[model samples]
Target: MFRPLELFIGLRYTRAKRRNHFISFISLVSMAGIALGVMALIVVISVMNGFDNELRTRILGMVSHATIAGVGESVRDWPEVIKKAEANPRVLGAAPYTEREAMLQGQRVAGALVRGILPEQEPKVSEVGKKMVAGELHDLVAGGFGIVLGKELAYKLGVDVGEKIVVYAPEIRATPVGAVPRLKSFTVVGIFEIGMEEFDSGLAIVHLADAQRLYQTDGPDGVRLKLDDMFKALGVARELAGDLGGLYRVRDWMQGHQNFFRAIAMEKRVMFMILSLIVAVAAFNLVSTLVMLVTDKQADIAILRTLGATPGSIMGVFMVQGVFVGVIGILIGVVSGVIMALNLEAVVKWIEHTFGVAFLSPDVYYISDLPSDMHWSDVGLIALLGFVFSLLATIYPAWRAARTEPAAALRYE
Candidate 1:
């Protein structure tokens, strides 16, 4: 159907002067629409990808890849568990931690999740030590009962470094007066900000020994593990659990935060579907353009049929013309989208500086910078979608052109 003769005529018709300027204008509009739609899809999808990556990195910086905990109140043999976890080649580091919910009182009172860590071993599985802004993690001595607070939590409690706060543990003790909550006074030695509300606004850290004494625990509650490949955390956790012989409960980071990540993924998919409508609308415009062109070129089609051109060849000519328009638009959109996505951050900064407007304010948003992460697979899929839509739009008009009768078409002429 797409022989040299048909190809030549199809290419010629695309460039030929049209008697009806409306038909030419409609064709141009269809091409522009496709280009704009494709560009928008690429940019939007890239931005979403960037946000997902950034959030994951920030959250994982505080959360370990996997954890192993005893079924009881505390893991009494935490050191042995760490040694066993270290034997796995995939496990890069391991650390034991104790966690509890507590209320802290300074000038103001607020609830927080209190965690205890060994200053030396904590760095093995998490980045809290490096994230400290005011003091060092090593400042918490065993007997000193020093504490580190999240930046937001510290602000809410109206305290800073060198100040003191009283922590009320959930555990209660019997006294002559009545049952009272176990409580202690801890000196605020440091502050850290993780840029996440979940941690920054409700987390506190203390020395492991101090935590054990205060909480009346035999040892750390669990051992945290860091894997070489975080994405393989589930498999690694499962293998570790199996090796431990059901004596302990093992969980991966995703299990703790699956709902949050799932929401982000669902939003991305919804945005993709919503943006695809723009491309679909643009591709459907091809139907109108080709239909008009077929009506305007009735004489030409009739002449071609009379000259022994097969109906299939006639259909091929119109299909080729429509595809050419789609291809050009897709190519332009792909090139423009790639260039824009690669420099999105710089472009956003420039706009903000020049316009004196902040798209994302640091006070309002944890991540104030515009980020873009383009995936080639997304680009390829969008291009294919455009091409398929364009091709489908050509069928009806091309079929109508192929069926034109020579005698009837030339009767008016």
Candidate 2:
């Protein structure tokens, strides 16, 4: 293959330091800009992914994935529903449940969702059975007019295990005293902590049989189903409900966290777009550097033109040099970012412990520690976008170099 003189000179111009120190400074800025953009994108995206994973694992551990209840008010045969749900392949655990919105009357009165559950089946479904802070599962198993309260709720109501609390609710009852507002008293058997404010402040648990008699229901109010995959809660719930027909109405946990997941997804997209602008600015910086180089190397370009070099080959040479700069910077940033992302949690923990300072507070946010999860698709996309922008940045300057007039440029020289 015949070598073009213009191509040789373009390569030489890229390597040679320009007289304009500002252009060299601009080139360095461009490299730094791209590196920062790539690194930020990877770190931010990974943290978002980590947050998502945490929600599925930590939050889902306490909540039922899906539930099946009667369409009108409550299901009469919740036990049968539990049996049917347990037969499903994807169902890991099934338990009868009853939930009622009631006011707990005590020193500090608070509204709460009182859920009734069977002690033996509780372990198969909710991790509450294992997260007992002040009591045992056996205490919940022995049938009695006893209940368990969340640690925070117990604190708010100034109650403890073995203490009595009254739950007030409105129910239609035919009694000698004629029912108006009904109240029930039960001894607290245990307290649990699941590391979430909502659960602690708003939830209470009791025995299934005792609660069924309190609510005057023939059976459980609903069947809480825990699935092998929480992500499939909606699909599995719909399919399971259709199988049961009009006997029950199905509900999934997706409804409870829809707004939450949506907000995270939206924020991820917006942040990615905003950060990409930094990469765009870096590519434009490449344009400025190459533009200045063309102006300085006018005489060299003219000499190459006079020696028979094509404009296309001149464009190729500048593109190659610009891509080289971009590729080197991107590779460095990607490697560094990935290593940091993989180890971010441990590093943040170490910093906090060493300095007695917390990077993030569980009280202020959903989590207490920094987290990251690498997604290779994001990496590939970043590299490809950087390459395209770099190639684009080469265009105007390379065209200017190719258009140099041999006669006019060499006239003074």
Candidate 3:
């Protein structure tokens, strides 16, 4: 099939050697810059998306999507509340929970947030049961005075299953000499790992009755609610609270941690905008290249005008040429970027292993490895942006070329 005159001429111009080799080099540089920018954006955005997803799953596995509590400290009738909360279509499960801060003394000392859970009910609302590495959650009998420690927490305390550890509560006990912190010793019966360093290092679980006795409460503090769609936590919580009435109040995961996720979102947006500038700069660099090309092709443009080529056709030629360059760069970038995003975790691990370095640590970041997840929508957006900028860059120079006077151009000849 025959190609359009504009396309054929445009492609030919791209291949034909110009008087100045530097112009050709600049064109090559522009294309490379666009490709590099697109690749970087794809990798960075994918990593951010991966982190967001990992964090949500790990956190929701330990923390509830929503909670129902009383205006006072403890919910007197959590059993009824749990039943009512689970009645909502969006609510999948509900379980009573109590949480308190305490210090553990073993071979080493560490602060811990102790959670109260019913082994049978917990699996319905959280992933704690499934996340256990050793021992069963059901081993925590109501009056057994046993505790389940997170893997990192146990490591910090330097204790293992069946070992004894002293937990000092904030509550005070009257003594002959003076009031002292209430302390009790419990045996570690199980260990769990959720892959979230924060939770792993600072959280522990015990029987609901054990927790209530330790906190000196007759009932749990709240009822944790599991939802089909966690994003709808706020709405579902509100509806559940309305339906329950009385001293019942609702709290969602987003309400407690919106700032953290918001910061991530803001950073992602800022990164996208910043990386886009690199593409914009590359796209606009075509302007200078096209301008020089028009100057060099003055005679050819004049001849074409005399041959009945319209000004629009002249513009089309340059636009097509610039778009061709942009399209190739974007395509190359997309392929490289997708490859990088797909294997970023393995690459990071390899680099770390070879260099004897660690990119993320459980002691600092909440995770121990880098992750990446690519989305085609992001690739499409970046490609569209680069193409638009490249097409726009051709306009001014093409207009200048179309306005050339055949008489003036031929006068010198």
TM-score, every prediction = 0.96, 0.89, 0.90
Choose 1 or 2, whichever is better by lDDT.
Answer: 1
Number of the predicted model whose TM-score against the real structure is largest:
1
lDDT of 2 by residue, 11-40 (tens): 565578778888878878888778877887
Candidate numbers sorted by lDDT from highest down: 1, 3, 2
- Among the numbered candidates, top lDDT falls to 1
Instruction: Return whichever of 1 and 2 wins on TM-score.
Output: 1
Cα lDDT listed for each candidate: 0.93, 0.79, 0.88
What are the RMSDs of all candidates, in order? Answer: 1.6, 2.8, 2.6
Query: Candidate 1: where is the Cα deviation over 4 Å?
Result: none
Q: Model 3 segments beyond 4 Å from truth? A: 1-8, 15-22, 173-178, 349-366
Q: Note the residue pairs that clash in candidate 2.
A: none
Q: Which pairs clash inside model 1?
A: none
lDDT of 1 by residue, 40-156 (tens): 999999999999998988898889999999897799888889999999999999999999999999999999999999999988998988889999999998999999999999999
Considering lDDT, which of the candidate structures 2 and 3 is the better prediction for this target? 3
lDDT of 3: 0.88
* Deviation in Å, model 3, residue 345 alpha carbon: 2.5
* Candidate 2 lDDT: 0.79
- The per-residue C-alpha lDDT of model 2 at residue 126 equals 84
